[model samples]
Target: MSEPTRRPPSGAATLRADKTAAIAEAVLDELAEHGYGRLSMEAVAKRAGVGKSALYRRWPSKQRMVIAVVSEPTVALADPPDTGSLRGDVLAALHAVADWLTHPRFSRILPDLIAEAQRDDELRRALALRIGEPRRARMIGVLDRAVERGELPPDLDRELALDLLGGLVYWRVSARGAALEPGYFERAADMALRALDARPRRA
Candidate 1:
């Protein structure tokens, strides 16, 4: 059964909640329109219709704000469900990753961040910790499941496996500016399975 609602928010509280949502939207817009290096607190503040202090209250710095906002949805979206087969699991994961990397806003934001991170050591560390690590951990869950179910070799080099999972799609979507066609996910999945020397299973 669904949980019942508690006391509703007061008028002032509702206004605050709405304002915060607006601010988050503004941050993503600012990030997408302007790369991290060029994104400014003033721009986000004006776009959000809130003073810069409001942003400061939420995050101490622009880097923290960008990482927190981008990381939350990213980590959630990349989680691959257990699909009961190595091919199915890998295919599902690749499709999820492709969707995320190709989403209109994210498609732009990520490449921009990647370029900016190359020159900014602080951002590089934050992106790896807050975004990259969490998503990789979820992909590891998929690998561990396959190993236990005897679909993949017991001694799978998991780091390489993780790289294989996203590399193809990420390269096409971000590096080459290539579009993914129908059945591309399957091809990528097959390649990853072959790379890891996965055992064949009955359909």
Candidate 2:
């Protein structure tokens, strides 16, 4: 059975929650402007029209606040139309990813976040848990369905498939200093499918 829903908090608690959300939004804006390492708590407080103590009361540190900023359910998978073919679904999902990654607003934060992940272990963990894991799971689900439909090998490693797909985008966005490019996702998906089909026979 599903778990029961918890009761909503009182009016004051609700107000505090709203204030916290406002602070988080302000912090996101600041990160967009200044990037992660240079983000200032005092600046966020001023932009949020709250005192630094208020932010500190809610989140102990800048890392914690950044985690909170990204901890929302902003990313999700699009339901495949299942045109009786895995290729179409995979292509569709890839296109969706390309569109998401290419958008100037969303794409700007990624390089920053990834760079931050290199040094701050706590932020890295939180980003992987909150943002990375769910998106990876969605891609894995797409690959799993392809396997079920016999479009790809059943023994294919889902994690590796995700790495391949993500690596293609990461290389362009983070490493090559290029913006999201057209046809990149389709090419990645094609290569991923080929790899899935080319698994060597077990001894």
Candidate 3:
């Protein structure tokens, strides 16, 4: 008789991938509802419809899980299209920031996490390292490309430029609760580029 047909190993891998995705969704929900300070693995497991052991299998601690869940989205959203010009790139990057800041779930979770991070040194460090630095680096790369293309001054203060770009969006969308109008991203990019290109006023 011919050998019996054998099942491929894909079943277990697919199940694991589904479970991991479910856990990530649960983490966002838990963070939105409870804030990072109050999030718990048991609660996440319950939310995900998976046992706590599944969580432990994926992450050794609550901190690790939270960092992974939050940072993955943050980094992924930091990516900006080249767009062939500094102005276009700046607008694109600002729009990305605005979108993330104003996202339904993140808009709530981010401010709470920032507040909690102020009191929690470890959490602050993790966020800065995993989310803040990577996002900033990408923005810096945008500026670098502009300089290489002769669109921006080589002596441009890239760090300050990134700050202005990010700070404006954060303040308007996250802090001031201002809604981004149809041309807001374009207008903001124009203003930021003007500021970046402006020469220092001598007394």
The top-ranked prediction according to TM-score is: 1
Q: What TM-score would every model get versus the actual structure?
A: 0.89, 0.75, 0.87
Better of 1 and 3 by TM-score: 1
Model 2 lDDT tens row, 1-203: 11122222345354376667678768768877888888899899999898898888766788877765654523543333465456666667666555545545445566788888899787888888877887776667877766766676878887877777667665776577676457766676677668667432233
Q: Name every residue pair that clashes in candidate 1.
A: none
**Residue range 60-154, candidate 3, lDDT tens digits:** 78987888777877777888889977788888988888888877778777888899889989989999999989989988888888877777888
lDDT of model 2 at position 7: 21
Better of 2 and 3 by TM-score: 3
TM-score of 1: 0.89
Q: Candidate 1 lDDT, tens digit per residue, 116-135?
A: 99999999999999999999
User: Which pairs, if any, clash in model 2?
Assistant: none
lDDT of each: 0.82, 0.67, 0.81
N/CA/C clash count, model 1: 0
Worst 10 residues of 3 by lDDT: 1-10
TM-score of 3: 0.87
